[model samples]
Each structure stands twice: as C-alpha cells, then as structure tokens.
Target: MSGSLRSREREMGVVILDGSTVRAFVGDEEVFNRSVDERFAALDLNGDGVLSRAELRRALETFRLLETHFGVDVVTPPAEVAALYNSIFDQFDLDRSGTVDRDEFRSEMRRILLAIADGLGDFPLQIVLEDDDQGSNLLQQAVDLEAAKTKAAASGK
Candidate 1:
C-alpha cells in the first residue's frame, strides 16, 4: 500500500485501503499515542462513551481546516472526504444499528488519525443504535449538528 508521506522523511506514516485494512506506523509509539489521544478528545464532543456521526463530521471539518492552514496537499476533494468518513462510520457501526460503542469508536478514530498524521486523507469517524428510539436520538443529533454548522458558517462565525 502506498502512503501520502514519504516514509523516509517522517517518523510515522499510514497506508489506507478501501476496505478494512488501515495500516499505521508504530515506529514512533509516543507520537502515535499522543496523536490518537488528541484526536479522540476532539471527536468526543459530549464526553459521552460513544461518538455520533455529527461529532465525527465536526472532526472532519477541523481536519479540513488544518489541512488548509498547513498548506498540505489534499488528494481527495471535500465531497469525497465526507463520503469516505460516512462509509467508515457505517463499517464501524458493526451492529447495523445506529451507535458505535466506545471501543469501536476509538479503534476507527485511531485508524483515521493515523491516516491523517501521514497526510493521507481527511479522516476521523463513528456509531449506530439498534432500537428505533435510540436510532432517532442519534439521527436528531446529526441533524442538529449539521444545522448548527450551516448557521455558523452563514453568519461568518
């Protein structure tokens, strides 16, 4: 698998594939740990045990901002980036339900952060709930979050 960053130039790198395999360089454990921690905190906005799709989408927004601020070359466009994370979210939601548990959320988020650390893609993702009630809860949160982002952007904030 090819990576966005030259392996020789960076202490850590990632090789992401279309399927389940997302490889991260464990060559620098300390850096990798720190990156994962920081990324996780940013995505778990409610400090809840699990992450919603809304939270993951917000994380992607930050990723896009950072990439632009740092002048990093993005191989994927914004729409594709959104679709990628959406696809990941579906996969991470193992139960076909609506919410991802803490363990699953962390694992997928780590994979995404690893890819981003290597400048591969705008990655960060999450969960599903099985019950109709719980699924509605998650869906509401997603709608609300998306609305807030739109409003904020429209107001130039």
Candidate 2:
C-alpha cells in the first residue's frame, strides 16, 4: 500500500499485462458490461441502485490505481486524500446527481480502463491481481476469457 505500486495479495501469480489485454477485455461488450455491473452492485452496499461517495470509495480501493485504500501513499496528507476522493466522485457523477447511476458508473469505468490501456500501450509488465472471481477484478477475467476462446477454437479445429 506504500512505496512501490506492487502490493501483496495471497493466492495470486504474476500475470503479464499490456494494452492489448486490457483493450481485449473492454472490447468485449458483454463481458465488460456484466463485469462492471457485478462490481457496481458489490460497491452498492445498500443496493440503492446508485453509488454513494462511500460506495465509490470502495470501488476505487478495488482499483488501487487512482488511490490506495488509503491515499496514494503514506506520506499523503489527509486533506489531499479527501480532495482526491472528492474529485474522483465528481468525475463519476457526470450529471452531478450527488450519486452515480449505472450508466455513469459504466461510462467512467470505460474511460478509466481505456486510459490504462493507452498507458500500457503494448508494454508488457508483470503484475499481481486478486483471485476474487466475483467479478471484482475484470482484467484477469479478460485474460481468462480470451484464453478460453482460443482453447475452444483450437479444439473445434
């Protein structure tokens, strides 16, 4: 959670990731939508059908990209962390409803994922992802999904 981006998670292995892997996942509309919905629901702890700031914070923690469960690093002051979370919530609350509906959630998620893909841009790097198969982490699912498709095609041939 501090210093390096690498954080430890039990029961995970290093996976090579690049822009193509991320793009492949986002490109699959069905998988992407379903996965987003699942994660969104998980964040919607109250099942209110919209994400509250607290809920959105949970989602960001899952992301651990924009900010850690804590702020970016241990050195970051509390005020900056609060502002950071506020900015993120504002970004997602496109209509400024003070809450994020599914559409807004999906739209913002797509933008973030695409930006990550652009940053990676074919540069493969080994990273660890949680094995939480509950759709919390979709990138790994994407990799698995693409592998399954490849396997199916090979067997069919």
Candidate 3:
C-alpha cells in the first residue's frame, strides 16, 4: 500500500484481539488497552450500572466537542449518530421495559463504546505519536526546500 493510505488506515483505530485481551494498533505499535468494561463504568453518568440514551448522547456530544476544539478529523454524520442512539435504545429496552435501568444501560454502553472506539482508529496517544513523526518530517522537508528555493532566487537563475 502507498504510505499515505497506510498512514490513514493507522489513523483509524483498528482493534485486534490477542487471546483474551484487546489491543489497538497504529502501524506496528500497540496503543490502546481496549477496556470497554472499564470505560463504560467511568462514563456512567448516574453511578448506575446501566447507561441510558441521555448518558450516551452526553458522551457523544462531549466527543464531538473535543473533536472540534482539538481539530481532530473524526467525523460522525447526523444520520449515523441518530442510528447509534436508536441502537442503544433498542438494546437496553430489554424485556420490552420501554426504559433502561442500570444493568441494561451498562450492557448497552459497553457495546456502544467498543463500536465507537473501534471506528475511531487508534487511541489518541497513538495518533499523536504518528502525527508528531509525520509533522516533523514534513516540516524538515519544507525547510530544506525553502532554503533551496532561496538559494536559487539569490543566484537570479
């Protein structure tokens, strides 16, 4: 694959299962822990075992804000975003309860987090490292090319 394509793939967090553990990879480097259960607990808004659509929506909104503020390229379309919420609602409405409690919420949250993380490409750390390297190289090349151009201009040639 071309380097640019390979790098783009690396940017999209790809989780590979290694035995019982999940590991996120960027190129040859492992970046994220792939702990969906832990992440779900941390994001649970009400200290309940389950996560509701409101909580999930809050999380997504926060993610969107971070992406915008930080200039992150991850983008979720409006339709897909709605579908995601609907999927969670359907899953957590177990027993046709028409409402999600702690357990149901937690279960759905775990699945949603995993799915979102999976699509987000490597964890933030991995992306940062990769971008740092790429940025440095581009900067250096730009500097060198500018210097050459300057020299050519000076020679009036």
Candidate 4:
C-alpha cells in the first residue's frame, strides 16, 4: 500500500496491526472486522443478498458492546437502533442496489472519513486545490477506501 493510503487509513480510525489484522477504532473503541462480519452474517436471515432493517436491528442487539465501548448510545429501545442501522445501510449501499458489496462498503468508509474530516476543517480551503501533491493524496485516499471495502467484505461486514 502507498504511504499516503496508509496514512489516510490511520486517519479514518483503522488500525493495521501486526499479522495483517485490521481493526476499526471509533473514538478509542476497537472492533475486530472479522468478529463484526461473523455477527452480521449470522443476522442475514433468509439467505438473502442483503440485510433488511429488521435483521440489522437484531444484529445491533448483538453488538451491544459497540455502543458501550464507542461511547455511542446506538442501542436503546431496539427500534431506534434498527432505524439508525437502516439509514446507515442505505448510506453504505452507495448505488442503492439494496446490497453493499466490497466496493460500496469501502466507498462508504471513505465518505464517512471525508465527512469527519470536513467537519474537522482538515480539507483544502479553496474550492479546488490544484497541486500534484493534493492530487496524489486524493488518489491515495481512493486506494485506501478500496482496501477498506475489500477488508470489510472479506470480513463479512
């Protein structure tokens, strides 16, 4: 992976540990991608290509630790979490294909990071920044996003 891509992944809360373990860190909360994938796969009932809102809600119930560790109150009456998951799923779906494959999942991660970076005022100031370094960084960002998506898909999240 490119150095720029690696840097972006680090910025987006992904930890590339030794032995190829990829973990996600949300505000000091750590979640293993493999574990999350297993949990989500178990929730994908009906052997369908996608997870319905109901299925996602059930998955959220199982993912209680996420809320606790992340310091995010995502789990509540269950319905609320379900709704939130539905929205999240839609955002991750990207192409609105009702299913999020590896590519779409990675794109969603990039979008999430971009949103956070934008919120933090870390992005470029100008309407359009013209520079090779900036262009290379942008390319690296895209590469990192793809890597993340591939990891997520392989992990089953």
Candidate 5:
C-alpha cells in the first residue's frame, strides 16, 4: 500500500484501540468525508465555505451553554474548553491565515473524533460527541422553527 494509505490505516487502528467503533470509516474514506461535510455545513454559520476564528469561537461559546439551554452537559470546563478551541483552531488553520476552510476543519475534526474514540487525546470525546449530537439537534430544530415562522409570515403577507 502507499505510504499515505498505510498511515491512515495506522491512525484508524490507533483510534479504535479504545474499543469504540466510530462509523466514519467503513470500507473507505467516504463515510468520514460525508460526516465532515455535514459538520462543516452546520458549523459554517454564514453558509460560507470558510470558518473564521470568530465564527468558530461563537459556536464554541454556544456549545458551552448546551447544559444550561438544552440540558445536555458535555462538561468541559469553561476555561479548558476555550483553550482547547484555540488549540484546535490553531492546528486547523494550517496556512495561519486566521481562518479555517471547510476542508481544513473537516480533516482536523475527523482526526479529533478519531483520537477521542481511541482514548488517545485530551478531548472528552464520548461526552462531547453524545451531547454535541443532542445540541446540534436542538439547534437544527430552532432553525427549522424559525424558517417555518418566516414562511408563515410570508404567506400571511
């Protein structure tokens, strides 16, 4: 196999060492790629293809409030979460241009999730992933409700 492919397999292996099976990799890279695509879409608040530091930070802050607003607590301490966000953001901004494009964010986040699954990283993967799903669902519901309201208003016009 090629070096890169071998490396990917190795990384996947390490990520699975903790006994949690993440479905991001099934037979190939497509599943993980799709997840990344979905997450990037959701994270891109402005619907742009890039995520500015400010945009991501705002999202992080909102995520921090998940416990209070949505009753799903992923419990990363406030300061630690901020530091972790900054660290991840720095790593994702490879070009150091102060922004992370979709591709960059997806790749980095994929790696993060994998490491979390493997119990190899400092990030609280299990709690965050589980609670993040709930949080995202809540956010999506809110967005859908707002859209419906707007549609209703337009119809009444």
Candidate 6:
C-alpha cells in the first residue's frame, strides 16, 4: 500500500507479490535469464565471465545487502559474516571450482528463487527492490512479463 517503487531513476515505491509472482518469473526463461544474468555480470567486476570468492564477498560488503533488512540493521560479528558469505559463495560454486561461472550462478539462483517462492506460499509480500542495475528486481520483471503477456493476448484476439 505504498507508493510506486522503481529503479533509482524513478521514485521509490513498494510492490506486493506472492509465490505465484515468483513462479511466473522463473517460468519465463527469457525474462528470468536476462534479468539474472545482468546481475551476475555486474557482480563479475573482474569481467572474467565468472564470480570469484573475493568478488562475491566484496559485493556483500559494499552493498551491506544481507546485513540490513529494509532499513533495519542486524549487527553481526565480522567472523560470522565472513563465514556466512563463504557458505553462500560455496553454494553458488556448484562445481566446487572456487568460482561461480554463469551457468553455476544461474542454476544456484534458480534454486534459491524457487525456495523463496515455496516459502512465500499464498501470502502477499510487499518488498522494495533496488534497480536491476544495482540490485535484484525479480518482482518487477515478473510483473512486466505478465503484463506483456496480457497485452499480447488482447491484441491477438
């Protein structure tokens, strides 16, 4: 019930979505890959076509993304934070290659998203997503995909 939440260029707003919303996103391979790949590319600061442990950790530190919950700070010890990030990095490195290639990253991301969708169940969850350029905008892409589908169906009729 908040104002529109969009990219940095647009006024910040909040949108409500649920399990079905995330399901739609994962179902649309084109939209999902494009959106998620953009994020992976940004995180691959070395331009190595893969994400190293340092790269992933740097992203977390720079963004403090996992630490703060919608402006609420959850203070954690540095050692614990490092371990958490290490575990996260390990999850993404599906092949245990010490780096997360695009495929590995994509596969891991898919699993994570599916888990989130399952957990959300039938509840309408409101969230503010940072710009796709800066952060994950999964919900926005899901909404846009559905809107495009509706528009296409209308035109076809």
Index of the highest-TM-score prediction? 2
Which segments of candidate 1 are over 4 A away from where they belong?
1-34, 65-85, 109-157
- What clash pairs does model 2 have? none
lDDT per residue for candidate 4 within 39-90, as digits (tens), equals 3455568666566656655644543433443334433576765566778778
Which ranges in model 2 have alpha carbons more than 4 Å from their true place?
A: 1-9, 62-73, 133-135
The reply for model 3, stretches above 4 Å from the true place, is 1-17, 22-42, 46-50, 60-80, 105-157
Report the number of backbone clashes for model 1.
Answer: 8
Error of 2 at 57 (Å): 1.3
Evaluated at residue 150, the lDDT of candidate 4 is 80
lDDT of 2 by residue, 2-112 (tens): 554445554675778888888898998998999999888888999999999998887676655544453344456779778988999999999988999999999998998
Which should have the higher TM-score, number 1 or number 3? 1
Candidate 5, residue 125: how far the Cα is off, in Å: 12
Per-model CA lDDT versus the true structure: 0.49, 0.81, 0.45, 0.45, 0.55, 0.77
lDDT of 5 by residue, 53-80 (tens): 7778776665444344334455566798
Residue 75 displacement (Å), model 3: 6.4
lDDT of 1 by residue, 1-157 (tens): 2214322321222222211112333233454345455555656778875668888667556334324323354566668877877886797776756766655655665565455445533353332212222222222233344456569999999
Q: Identify the superior model by TM-score, candidate 3 or candidate 4.
A: 4
Each candidate's number of clashing pairs is 8, 0, 7, 0, 0, 2
Candidate with the greatest lDDT versus the true structure: 2
- When 2 and 5 are scored with lDDT, the better candidate is 2
Cα error, residue 153 of model 1, in Å, equals 48
TM-score of each: 0.37, 0.82, 0.33, 0.35, 0.50, 0.78
- Whichever of 4 and 6 has more lDDT, that candidate is 6
